[model samples]
Target: MEFFKGDKIYNFMGKRLPFLGFSTILVVTSIVLLLTKGVNFGIDFAGGTLVQVKYEKAAPIDKIRDILNKTKEYKNSSITKFGSDDEIIIRVTTSTNSVSSDLSDEIRNVLKGTGNFEIRRVDIVGPKVGGELREKGLMAFVLSLIVIMIYVSFRFEWRFALASILALVHDVTIALGAVSLFGIEVNLDILAAVLTLLGYSLNDTIIVFDRIREGVQTSKESDLSKVVNESVSRTLSRTTLTSLTTFFVVATLYFFGGEIINGFAFTLLVGIIVGTYSSIFIAASFLVQLKFSIEDFRTKEVEKIKKQKEKEKMRAMFEQGTV
Candidate 1:
């Protein structure tokens, strides 16, 4: 099934400079934001206490805050509405990662005055444990990038592989920048979202690169710009549809999935759009900058591709009754 009919070609590579410039600005801005504002790391990595509670009626957030303020330990804690108004989540930064019965008792007792409520659960993490988790999370992310370099380099030559990786970095940095910009809570789930988008972005890029390779092998065109433009146009319909459909689903999750998954959804939301853009513009532009030509292959493959291009041209000539 062909999404694009006819021989029309779009100048995708021709306008790459603007998109690349825009992407560069966004990436630099995101980095600055991360260095300045930073991300809001959840208790999962910051080392803290989480106290979840449920009330038969809507939770009185203000009244509960006032009541908890009376105590010293939880006075500086944070409270947020959970799934419903009746449920609430309380976070308290702790010096130690250890769970103390006294702390739970204190939190439960302090909120009890707000009205009849049930303590759903309590989670505690100390400073050292939080630091370790934070380190590991960062390590995991970096290691994934390393693996991508290895995997993609194996799939294509170094030039294409490098382009793919740079495009991914662009998507990830901006997504993280958005998180920091919006103060999204960084947690295990959010990290998972970041990693998930890596594969997705790479998949989109590989598709375009694959198309370019086929075009090079068969098209009787020496002009790289035209070949790239044709390849991208052929795949534009699929990329647009896939990204649009996925965006709608993720947008639903961001709007309706509640605060619990908002960060995760937002990461994916930015990822899909940026990923699509980078794959088409950033990745392809980098390939063009690398001076990709028939030289990437050896004598045999180059000669073979030349022969294939000749056959294709002859076939077209025969159809036109010109030879």
Candidate 2:
């Protein structure tokens, strides 16, 4: 399980330029793809009606799809088995911004002869609501990014924070690009996945940054590049272990979790790979470019000294019974 040795000093920073070049091309291509072909929006962001049906017996999925396709009114309808073999959920895109109250009844009527089925429930979303949800999702993303930047800025130097934020942006942009490129249906669940990705990527970057900061402070080496390489090498095993563990779980969900969660699983799968990559290559590379100064370490030392002085002062006051 140990992918790297404890004392190994990997030269991860040695070929950082080529990795940076590759990342730049990838980020640019992803941006282009996103612009030219936007992600496919689902009912969570696009108005539609969901009809849940339960058949008396096992449902014929393909036959039901064919039946829906042949009907001009429900030609664009999509269906998937949700619960048991006898139950299924059907999503019908509304031709207009409004949804018909009798959509479920109409679906039942259309499939009357196919099987003895009961309409379990129906959920309708309006275009206005969907639009609002879409706006909110985007707002959440932007606000989270801003908050993380502010946090990192306070946690470390401005340059380190800037680098961390850029790496986050890089991870998100490419993940969105992959969703767009594959024409994945972007829904509320998928939005959740994207947000999850931001947290995951940020955690990885923070781990590496903390190590680098520690290495810079404690090591005698004045060369920032050497410090970065050693820091990354030290933390490589932890990062890889975490990434692989999460990837395997998400991969299982993508493969066996069924169609209901396909998009969500796929989003996480891509996010795991891209997030892990950007954390090491993109975030760490940005750190190398920023050039860590010993002065940064001095700031921490000053704070520690102040804290120690405060502790000593409190001890004296307590000993004299004047605390």
Would you estimate the TM-scores of all the predictions?
0.86, 0.83
Residue 62 lDDT (model 1): 90
Which residue pairs collide, candidate 2?
none
Q: How many backbone overlaps does candidate 1 show? A: 3
User: How does model 2 fare in lDDT?
Assistant: 0.87
lDDT of model 2, residue 159: 80
Candidate 2 structure quality by residue, lDDT tens digits, 1-323: 77989898888788899998998988999999988887788877997877888898999888899988998767878897774799998888874534446777678778887889889788777778999999999999999999999999888778889899889888888888999998888999999999999999999999999998888778888888888888888888999999999999999999999777888998999999998988777798887787757666677778999999999999999999998
- Tell me the TM-score of model 2: 0.83
User: Residue 155 deviation, candidate 1, in Å?
Assistant: 1.7
Per-candidate clash tally? 3, 0
